[model samples]
Target: MDVSVIGSGYVGTTVAACFADLGHRVVNIDIDEEVVATLEAGEPPIHEAGLPELVATHAGPDSTGRLRATTDYEALLDTDVTFLCLPTPQHADGSIDLSIMEAGAEQLGATLAETGDWHTVVVKSTVVPGSTADVITPAIEEVSGRTAGTDFGIGMNPEFLREGTAVEDFQIPDKVVLGADDERALADMHTVFDPLVDAADAPVVETDTRTAEMIKYANNGFLAAKVSLINDIGNICKEFDIDAYEVADAIGLDDRIGAKFLRSGLGWGGSCFPKDTNAIIHAATEAGYEPAMLKAAVAVNDRQPERFLGLLDEHVGVADRRVAVLGLAFKPGTDDVRNSRAIPVIEGLQARGAEVVAYDPVAVENMRSHFPDIEYASSAAAALEGAHAALAVTGWDEFAALDAAFDTMATPVVIDGRRIIERREGLTYEGLTW
Candidate 1:
């Protein structure tokens, strides 16, 4: 299958590379010249585990000519399938802002107007239900001057790739969803994903576009709620002076409740959870139904950073003192800092007049854009040195190995948010949930 992915952001780039590796000829189309150039140079524009190797093997010079990138919209006309991987950012009210997706569809439709052969356009981006049928399809139809399901096919294939393990997730997915109104679109999607389906032996769900969109939101919403529910339980356990991890471990023994997302600390905060939860909440409210449980989950996640800062306040006054913040990224194995719990933690520390010094293995440069004035240490030990107290925000594996670094702190106070640190002699350690 010859596939063209529009918008070379995180999803676009990863999907393009993975499809190429799956034995499909893929061309990544994006408006950014820098991203296109980077792909052409055989380098990934984003920081994802195993993405560099895939891009190097399939794209750039001296590699298999299965993958390439271009800045032209006309590139889509040559491909049998085009996946709309543009970002659907949120508005101030938490509703999905589909301006980018609509604009991309219009451009794609205009380019497709030149061709008479049927081409399938798959919505790979996460959008609210009814977005494809209501907003995106109309945008493309108005621009192309052609009828959908006739001249061009429309399909919705939501991506379930996690940032840290996107390549692995794509290669070995738990499930593959293919949604389309017409058999032509569905057949085209099946042809495009047949290689991956056969290789991974993954379950395939065939449904309508609306159901497919809701599956993504519902999937994220359930996971977000589950994390918050655990955090809520963890907070209760804290009140009773109970170790949440112990309780969680025992409860996880039950086959009904699995152990995944059970380690509750600062709650869920990444690109997908926050955006998808808020988007679904807003969509539910707009449809004359209020989702109270989802709203409470968001509230609980918001309160975690404050609770962490409050724990710091209990140990010592951070005002007029230096505080070492370990880990800036939302999770380990990825450098994405969007909606990281560390953001509010840093803000709370600053509100108390504390000098912030933060460190992450790969997220320092990304976090610099958020707090350029704050001190960024070269290493975890460097951040802890001469600081009044240390707060562990992310559960990086390196932080678990620190033994003597606590001796360098002026006060030797440690507040662990992710429970990656252990209490030892000559160090006052406080776990957020344990």
Candidate 2:
């Protein structure tokens, strides 16, 4: 299969590399020259586990030359299938700003007009239901002057890749969604994902474009709601002087409530959960239906950081004090800081006039852009050194091993958001919602 993927962000790069690894001739199309150059050089533009190896093996001089990158949208015309992996970022009012996806679709439509051969355009970007058929299809048809399902095929194939575990998720997804109106587009989608379908024996979900789009939103929304529910439950457990983990464990025994995303901590703060939940809420409201459960879930998630800071306040005054933030990334294994819980924690610390020192194994550089004035330490120990207190925002594995580092803190008070720390004699530990 000859594949072209647009947008070289996290999802774009991951799918491109993985597609190439699956024996497809892949070309990544992006507006960013640096990202295109980085891909051409066999280097991953983003930090994801198992991505560099895949890129190195399928792209560049030493590899099979099956994967390459270009800044030109016309390059996509040469490919049999094109995947729009663009970003549908959240707007000010929590509605999806589909300008990026629209622009990409217009350009792709124009590019497809140059070719006489049939091409399939798959919307792999996360979007609200009816977007693929209503927004994207119309945009492409308007620009190309070609009809969909006749001149060019359009499909909605949403991606389920997580930030840190994207490669593994792509390789072994629980299900492969194929959404298309016509038989040809459906067969094209199956062909594109045939290698993966055969490799993992993953279930194939055949549905319409709108349903496929809704599936992505519903999946993320449910997971986000689940975490928020547990966090709410954990908050109650804390009031009762009960261990939330024990409650979660007992609930896990029930077949209906399988315990994934059950770990209640600082709450979810990545690109997916917050954006998807807010978008759906906004969309649902506009349609005259209020999603009460999702609204409560978001309320719980939004208050977790404040709850964490309040716990810190119980030990000492943060005003004019130096506090250490143990992690900056949303989660371990990736350098993505978009909507990370650390942002709120740091902001709360700063609001109290606390001089903040932050540390992350790989996300420190990314965080510098968000907080240039805040000091960043090379090591977790360095961040903890002489600090009045420390807050663990991300549950990195290395944080679990920090037994002796607490002794060096000026006030060994640790407010753990992720429950990644253990109680020791020398340190004062407080879980945000244990």
Candidate 3:
């Protein structure tokens, strides 16, 4: 299959590289010249695990010529399938902003007008349930002057790739969804994903485009709610002086309740969870139904950062002290700092007049855009040095190995938001939810 992916952001770049690795010829189309050049040179434009190796092997010089990138929309005319990987950011009211995706669709549709053969356009970006049928399909039709089911095919194939393990997730997916009302569009989508389905032996879900779009939202919504529910439980456990981990362990023994997302701490924050949850909530409200449980989940997630800071307040006053913040990325194995829990944690510390010094293995440069004046340490040891207190916001693996770094702190009051640190002699440690 010859596939072209539009918008070479995190999802676009990873999907293009992984598609090529699955034995398909892939062309990544992006508006950014630097991103296109980086991909052409076999270097990843984003920080994702295992992406560099895949890009190097399939793209650039001295590699199999299965993958390439281009800035021209004309390059997509030759491909059999085009996947829209543009970002659908949220509006002020938490509704999805589809301007980017609509523009990309219009451009793609205009380019397709030059080709006589039928081409399939797949919606790979996460959007509201009715977006594909209501907004995107119409945009493409209006531009190309072609009937959707007749001249060009349209489908919705939402991506389930996580930031940190996108490559692995794509290669070994638990399920593959192919959503389209047109038979030709659905058939073409299955052909494009047949390699992955056979290789991973994953379940194939065939449904309408609307259902497909809702699946992505429902998936994220459920996971977000689960995390918030546990955090809510963890807060109750804290009131009773009970270890949440112990309670989680006992409850996880039942098959009905799995152990995943059971470690409750500062709540869920990342690109997908926050955006998708809010989008669905807003969409549901617009449809004359209010989702109370989802609203409660968001409320709980919003308060977790303050609760984490409140624990630090119990140990010592940070109004005139140096506070070391470990980890800045939303989660480990990626450098994306969008909607990281550390944001509010840092804000809370600053509100209390604490001098913030933060450190993350790969997120310092990304976090710098958020807090330009705060101190960024070169290493975890460097951040802890000469600090009055330390707060662990992200659960990086290296933070668990620190033994003597606390000795350098002036007061040695440690607050663990992720439970990655251990209590020891000569150090006052507080776990957010133990």
Candidate 4:
């Protein structure tokens, strides 16, 4: 199959590389000239695990030429299937701002109208329940002057790829959803993913387009709520002077409560959880129903940074002190700092008149955009040395191995948010929730 993916962001780039690797000739379309050039050079614009090597093998001069990128949407006329991978960021009031996705759909519709053959368009970006059938289809139909199911096939196939482990997740996904009302359109989607399903032996979920869209929101919302629930429980355990990990381990033994996303930490933050949960809450409120549990979950997540900061304040006075921050990326293995918990930690430190020095394996450059005046260290050891206190915000593996590094701290105080540090003798260690 000759496939075209629009918008060369994280999801767009990953899917394009993976599709090409799956033995399909794929073309990536993006408006940014620099991003297009980078992809054409067989290099990824984003820092994701295993993406560079995949792009290098499938694209550029040294490889099979199965993958390519372009700045023009007109290239879509030559492809059989197109995936709309545009970003749907949240608005100020929690509703999704669909301006980007709308524009891409209009341009794709015009491109499809120019061609005589039929093409399958899939909404690969996460959206609200009725977005694909209600908003996207109407915008495309108005411009193209063609009916959705008859002239062109439109469907919703949401992506479940995590940031750091996107390649592995896509290759071995537990379930593959193909949402379409028409038989032909659904079959087209199956054809596109047949190779991946066969490789992973994953389950195929057949459903309507609207149901598929809801599945994505429900999936993210449930997981986010679960993390927040655990955080709430962990907070109670902290007050009782009990170890939260031990209790979590005991509960995880039951088959009903599996041990994924069970670690109590600084709460959930990323592009997916915050955006998806807020979008659903906004959508539900518009329909005149208050989502109580989800709202409480968000409340719990928001208060965790303050709780961690308060623990640090109890240990030492942050006013007129130098504090070191460990980890900036939301999680390790990626450089994306969107909705990272480190933002709040740094803000709290600065609010208390503390000098902030931060360090992450790969997220220092990204965090610099948020806090330009703060000092950044090249290594964790450099950030710890000469600091009055250190706060661990991310659970990167390197922080777990810092035994001698804690000895260099002026006050030897460590407040861990993610439980990624080990308690040692001669060090003042405080875990947010043991």
Q: Give the alpha carbon lDDT tens digit for every residue of 145-172 in model 3.
A: 8989999898999899988999999999
lDDT digits (tens) for residues 1-434 of candidate 2: 99999989999999999999999999999999999999999999999999999999988879999999999998887788999999999999999999999999999988888878899999999999888889999999999999999998989998899999999999999999999988899999899999999999999999999999999989999999999999999999999989999999999889899978889999999899999999999999999999999999899999999998999989999899889999999999999999999999999999999999999999999999889999999999999999999999999999999888889999999999999999889888999777
Cα lDDT over the full model 2 = 0.93
Which pairs clash in the backbone of model 3? none
Residue 346 lDDT in candidate 3: 97
Clashing pairs in 2: none
lDDT accuracy of residue 121 in candidate 1 = 93
Please identify which of the two predictions, 3 or 4, would achieve the higher lDDT against the true structure.
Answer: 3
Q: Give per-model TM-scores.
A: 0.99, 0.99, 0.99, 0.99
Q: Put down candidate 4 lDDT per residue, 8-75, tens digits, no spaces.
A: 99999999999999999999999999999999998999999999999999988798899999998999
Residue pair clashes in candidate 1: none
Count of residue pairs whose backbone atoms collide, per candidate: 0, 0, 0, 1
Cα lDDT tens digits for candidate 1, 1-434: 89999988889999999999989999999989999999999999999999999999999899997999999999888799999999998888999899999999999989988989999999999999999999999999999998899998999999998989998999999999999988999999999999999999999999999999999999999999999999999999999999999999999888899988899899888899999999999999999999999999999999999998889999999999999999999999999999999999999999999999999999999999999999999999999999999999999999999989889889999999999998889988888887
Looking at model 4, residue 421 earns an lDDT score of 90
Whose lDDT is higher: candidate 2's or candidate 4's?
2
